[model samples]
Target: MAVHKLLDDLYEHSYSLIAIHSPLKDYRLAYFLNHQLSLKLKRTKDDFSYIENTSFSTFHYNDDTTDTAWHLITNISKNVVNETRDTDLFGIKSTTVLHYLVPEYKKVDYFLKIDNGDFFYQLNAVLKIINEMTHVVTAYTVDPNQLKSKNNLIFLSNA
Candidate 1:
């Protein structure tokens, strides 16, 4: 399946915190994200006014300028450690399957830091979906407490 179509499906189901990867694609990881976001923007022309307005954004640490990409990616994982906002959905796309197995960053952080409440169930549902997809491509199950001690300093939390 096309990567964009996969993301579109997730978006439709109200899963804002998502991660996507495609082993079949040979292009840069950013290419798929930019393509999909632009398409969504075009399709949602009447309601969405900005790239962020589409309700999802792509976050990457490795723009290929430095060695901090992994650090940045981990920091993002740390900060969201249980994000509660339903409005914040993001995707991490990469052609390499190894990128998918970077030691439980996003999934673990989000799961561990979330506070118990109404959104917990919903978030669990989304994580399950994400895990299903991740496992298919990377063979690693998303574990909530997988990276409790892991730290990356580049993308430090503002809070």
Candidate 2:
């Protein structure tokens, strides 16, 4: 892809990312982002509207769906800040993030929650493993249920 074309393509479809829908893709976002969100990325007709979500940290991705949502959400937060010059584009207020983890998280700061049902309960082992990997200040998970018209800062925590 030409430099301009690639930048143009990234602009339109940049904000929305194709996350690791399953444990299989978390460690390799390029494959899934390229394969999964291909159509969305095509909407950009040019201009620096979007940049690829490449927030590489010491925290490398691993094939663990346990807290994959949390890691991805944190990545989104850092990505927005780094990519958008740290501007709060949507003018968000309080953000509430909901994620499903089998064992649930402890002493978490920022907006976050673990579902009180089987989704998390079933994946208990995975949740424990993922939780062991992180110890940071982050707002993770956006509840699809709260996605009501614009009041979705909390909902966007997942995005």
Candidate 3:
């Protein structure tokens, strides 16, 4: 499917559902923090922390709450510069429900509606990061343990 189509499909879904499918593993989370977002992941036995330059923060995602990270990444992908009225389902300025899945960042309306070309450009930049993170996460695990969770993937943001 085209990236735009893929993104629209993703945006309509629940982040909680996506993360349970293996997108929120320790390795993948670490990769996203350290590489994709240019943040540092530090484990201290009891918690996971992410740091970017001087902005240091910590996050936790057991089987219950980990899917949130995927939600943000997924929803952010919906930012299309030239989306028609049909694709603008979330309103002109909306904070993705994905961010609500994750607790680190304050919920704010932050996605910018852009054109197809700009949308693809932004998606391409992040896709590289997501792809790399995916590779790192996929290489080590044959069966992802998180997928066993039976929680419903629901969008809990400004939906």
In terms of lDDT, the best-performing candidate is 3
Rank ordering of all candidates by lDDT, starting from the highest? 3, 2, 1
User: Taking the tens digit of each residue's C-alpha lDDT, what string does model 1 give over 1-159?
Assistant: 655434322321111123343342222323433353221111111221122212221233222332221111211211122334555475433231111223345332211122222334555554444345422242222333333432221112221
What is candidate 2's CA lDDT for residue 23?
31
Q: Which pairs clash in model 2?
A: 11-50, 96-154, 102-120
Query: Looking at candidate 1, what is the lDDT of residue 101?
Result: 21
Candidate models: Cα lDDT each: 0.27, 0.28, 0.30
Candidate 3 Cα errors over 4 Å, as ranges: 1-24, 27-31, 39-121, 134-152
Estimate the TM-score of every prediction: 0.24, 0.21, 0.24
Candidate 1: Cα lDDT at 153: 19
Ordered list by TM-score, greatest first: 1, 3, 2
Clash counts per candidate, in order, are: 4, 3, 7
lDDT of 2: 0.28
Query: Candidate 1 — which residues are off by over 4 angstroms?
Result: 1-119, 131-149, 153-159
